[model samples]
Every structure is written in C-alpha cells, then in structure tokens.
Target: MSAATPCVLVIDDEAQIRKFLDIGLRAEGYEVLLAADGAQGLALAATRSPDLVILDIGLPDREGHDVLSELRQWSHVPVVMLSVRDAESEKVKALDAGANDYVTKPFGIQELMARLRALLRSRPGEPDAPQRYDDGHLMIDLARREVALDGTSLALTRKEYAVIAMLLRHAGRVVTQQQLLRDIWGATHTQDSHYLRIVIGKLRQKLGDDPATPRWLKTEPGVGYRFLTDH
Candidate 1:
C-alpha cells in the first residue's frame, strides 16, 4: 500500500484478529493501524485520524461501546463493529450507540470488504455550493449548515447539525446508528449511541416534536432511526 493510502484503524484485543485485518486491509491497498484495546484505540484515533476504524465490541481494557462514546466527543471517522454476539438486541444496541455497521462473528471477508467499499463511496465530499431541502416547514441549508423550522432558525451545535443533516439527506429511510455515526461523526464513533440520543433529544425539543408522538424523527425500536419527511 502506498503511504498516502487511506488509513484504517483495527481495534481488537485478539492478536489473530488484528493480524487478519492488517493483512486483509493492506492487501486491499489501505494503510492499517492496530490497537489492542479500547483505550489505545481511542488514543490512536485522536492522534492519527484514520479514514476508517474496525472495532471489536469486546476489549480487554474497556468495553467497545464506551470507547465509541469517547470517540464521539470529538472525531467523526467511520467505524465498523465486529462482535461475536449475534442477538438482535445486541445489534440494535450497537447501532443505537453510533456504529456505522456491524458484522457478526464468523463473517466472510468478502462481505466485510464490500461493505467497506460501499461506505467509503457513499461518504460526501465538502459542500462547494449551498444545499437546501424543504418539505414545506422543514428547511435545511447545507452550505450554511443550518436548519429551520417553520421559517424560524433553530439553534444547533455542530454535532447536532451534522446528525440532522445526515437524516435529512436520507429522509424516509431507516438510517442505522452505525451509518449515522459514520456520516456525522466519522467511522471511529459508530458505537456511541448516547451521543445520538442527546443530539436527537435536542433536535426534538427544538422542532417541538412530541416524544410521545413524534412526527418527524421516528425511532425504529431495536433497529436504528428514521426521518419521517411525510410528516
């Protein structure tokens, strides 16, 4: 792999897993970095700013979810989670936590590679021209990175703007937590679901969305999140 190739961080406690990822990613023309646990992974993520991260849910030092939460505090690298736990609830939890994608244990290498390519291809480049979308009362201006409700400008933080923008871009579709995390926070934070919740809560409050009967932002209950533009 060339030195300038996109970097990927592999965070897994298992040495064999790390070795496998390093070999596979490098063979596919990516520069790979390895970390044995969540703490080291976070440190490497902050300092190196890899283009993508492949994280394992089980870590020796800290849970993968906790590491993802910490990463969400700053960076937005794409994160793909690998876990042996195949329960639907577990998948949902990982997705909700902000993972871009999840692969159950004993996954095929080809499938993982394909998913990685798809993710990288879908990532948007910097906005050169202004982007605006409106379904009547809801308006989003991408160039300005702003959202307005009923012509009233809504105050939002950077992360909040990123989240809502992502949802609006894929309005009416179920955007998994992992996808949201990767799009908004980048690959490294795909496991930070609490961040998603906090930001979504702020958005709901700003838009006057009733948590009891949300019209715009809808929850998928054990899946991910969806933006209901029809509302």
Candidate 2:
C-alpha cells in the first residue's frame, strides 16, 4: 500500500508457487502481487509498475518469453525468470529476450531473496546516494559539486558537473539518454539529445577520456552511457 514498499509481482500459474511467494515476499517486507498467466502478468506490469517481476517460463495462456517481449516494448523493469528447464539454451534465450536473471525451479527462498536484493540495489529507479567517490585517480564530492583528478582539482563547467555527478552516482549502470536529458536538462529538452552529446563530450575531454575506449565513461551506443567503476 505505501509507495515506499518495494513491490514484487509473481507470474506463475501454479497455485502453490503463488501462495509460497506471496507469504515469503510479504515476510521479507515486499508487497506481492500474483498473476496466473502471461496476459494477467502483462496487465499487472503495465498498471502496477512493480519494482520487480518473477516470471515463470510456462504459462497457461502463452510462454513467458512472449510476455517478456511485450514488457520490453515499454518497460525496463527488472525481471527474474523462473523455469523448470535448467538447460543452457533456455537460460540464454530468456536472458537474450530481456530477462535480467534466471532461477531454475526448486530454488532456495533465501537465494531468491538475495538475488532480489541485488537487483533492487542496482536498479535504475534507486535514489542517488553515496555523495563522495574516490578511486585514487578520480575523486568527486557530489554535495559540494567538486571534482579532482590525480590530487589536483579539475575545473568543470556547471553542465559538466551535473552530468558527471549523475553518472558517478550510478556507476557501473547505463543511465538512459532520456533519463539524463529530463533530469539534467528538464522534460522539454528530452527531444534535444544533441545537447546531451555536446555536454558529455566536454566532460570526457576534461576527464582526459577517449570516447572510443573510455576509461571512466562508456557509451551505450544509441541507448545511453555508463560510468565504468572498475578502474
């Protein structure tokens, strides 16, 4: 009910599984929703916008892959697939189709909860945190809007500071172009992706980074950019 409660949707036709997940997730402080088929799952996904989805490969209406295909059209919600088939090809297929992680059936509840926590920790909707970052070479204090490289302070323009601060806040994860544009440049500027490109270029140059083989910032091609954390 409360907006802060992390929500999990379990899409499985098996009644026992649904009941099991409902109790376990609730006990773990998650708001749980259940669906018996792909259609219901997709509907809940669209309407509820749950924080995570646990999808079963086999459904009465259709395959979960088809459900994932539809979900990927508009949503990038983290999905952990559940399947009885532990075959390599199935896991590959599900991941390729947009499943974030795969857990074979007969899994331990503790392991599943751990995976859920890991996914949530890395999830994009997470609020910005950990104000200070230092990897010896590059250091940033987001709250103070300060950055230093190799012990010397690096001068950065306002836009450069804003973008880099956001990137550093989400290190090791791709921050989508639209998200950057809207957050940094306002919602109306979402269509002006060129502005983001120009700003990012300047930031890279100041950081002494090469776009082709970036040490700190990596381009996600047409989608977005990710800050490389493993220096």
Candidate 3:
C-alpha cells in the first residue's frame, strides 16, 4: 500500500463488530488495525501511530472515555467513538473528552465512511499542508515559495514567509508562540515572544490584516496564533 493510505485502528471488544469494521474499512481503502480492549488499543496507538482511531465506548477492560483521555495526553490523532447508546449526552461527553466524531452501533458503513473522510480532510495529524492556498485576495504557493496579494507578489523576508507558511499549514488551529519560536528561531529563542510578535505583525500588515478585526491571523492572547481560514 502507498504511504499516503490512511490507517484506522478500531478498538472494540465485540468480535463480530471488529470483523465487520475490518472488512468495511478495508473495502473503503483504509488500512485497518484491530484491538480487543482499551489496553491493547492504547498500546497499538502508541506503537503503530495510526492516522485515526475508532474506539468502542464500552470496552472489556475499561471505558473508552478513559482511554481517550489517556491518549489525548500525548497524541492528537483523530478519534471517532463507537457506542450502542445514541443519547445526546453521551455524544457530548465523548466529544468533550476529545473524540472527533461518534458513530452508534448498527451504523451504515457509507455514513461512517463519509465521516471518516471528512475528519481526515481536516485532521490535525496530517503530515503536510496542501501545495497552495488561495483565499481570493491572498495566494500562497508553498512549493514555489511565493506569496501574492491582490494580484501582485509581495516581498516577504525569510522569517515572514516562515511564520505565514507555518500558520497556513496548521490553519484553523492555534500554533503556540513557543512552538513557532522553537521551530523557526530555535529552542534557545523560545522565550523570546517579541520576535514572533514582530514577524506576525509584519505578515499581517503585508497581507492587509488587522489584529483587532483580523481577516487572516487571530491572536490567542498570551497563548498563540491561529490562521483563520474562514475569515
């Protein structure tokens, strides 16, 4: 299989459910991994690093919520909780606990597949950004290292491009100040928030973004920055 193939780990205690999902997921072109209980699931998650996890809420050893909480401590891999209970509260609890989506038992395979595709498209664990991003006014061609705004190329310094590119790659999520600093300027400069602020300011100005009513960059205030794909 190609490296781009998405691997999905299903952690369900039901033998029939596991087999059902294994066949269904494989038929949908997803590489599937199976775990009978929470412990084995957690182990596979840590070792195999599958792109997504389909976890049963009721496991033999422990509740799936506990497993999800433990997994969230380290990994951001997308999780879709499986349960026989279709209660709204149960769904809310799973989502609050960090499950990306929830599927009740006896679900249509096509519906489940659709949800999986949507989650993977917006998955935080995606390894790379799309080659280009164009939001009407701004155009970024990452492969060519080019940035254009309003039909004209704008001159951006190395640091400026790096900051915007990093933000674009993780669009719709907060990229912490320390993360940007460490990735762009190195570990020693992680404490230097000013450098990040300056670069962000420059990029915003060139892109005609206002920090107060930002169209592209949004400040998380003392935490980090998020690139706004919607705005």
In candidate 1, what are the lDDT values of residues 138-220, reduced to their tens digit?
88888787788999898889888888777766666656677677778877897887888899899898888887898888886
Point out where model 2 deviates above 4 Å.
1-3, 125-231
> Taking the tens digit of each residue's C-alpha lDDT, what string does model 3 give over 1-231?
134799999999999999999999998888999999999998777655688999999998999999999888656889999999999999999999999999998899899999999998887645667678898899998999999998899999999999999988888766778778888998789789899989998888898898999988999765578888885
lDDT of 1 at 17: 86
Note the clash tally of each candidate: 15, 0, 0
Model 1 ranges off by over 4 Å: 1-4, 125-231
The TM-score that candidate 3 achieves is 0.55
lDDT of 2 by residue, 31-121 (tens): 9989999989887775556889999999999999999997786567899999999999999999999999999999999999999999988
**lDDT: worst 10-residue window of model 2:** 121-130
Native-to-model Cα distance after best TM-score fit, residue 49 in candidate 1, in Å: 0.5
What TM-score do all the candidates reach, one by one? 0.54, 0.55, 0.55
**Predicted structure 1, TM vs. truth:** 0.54
Better of 1 and 2 by lDDT: 2
Task: List the candidate 3 regions with Cα displacement exceeding 4 Å.
Answer: 1-3, 125-231
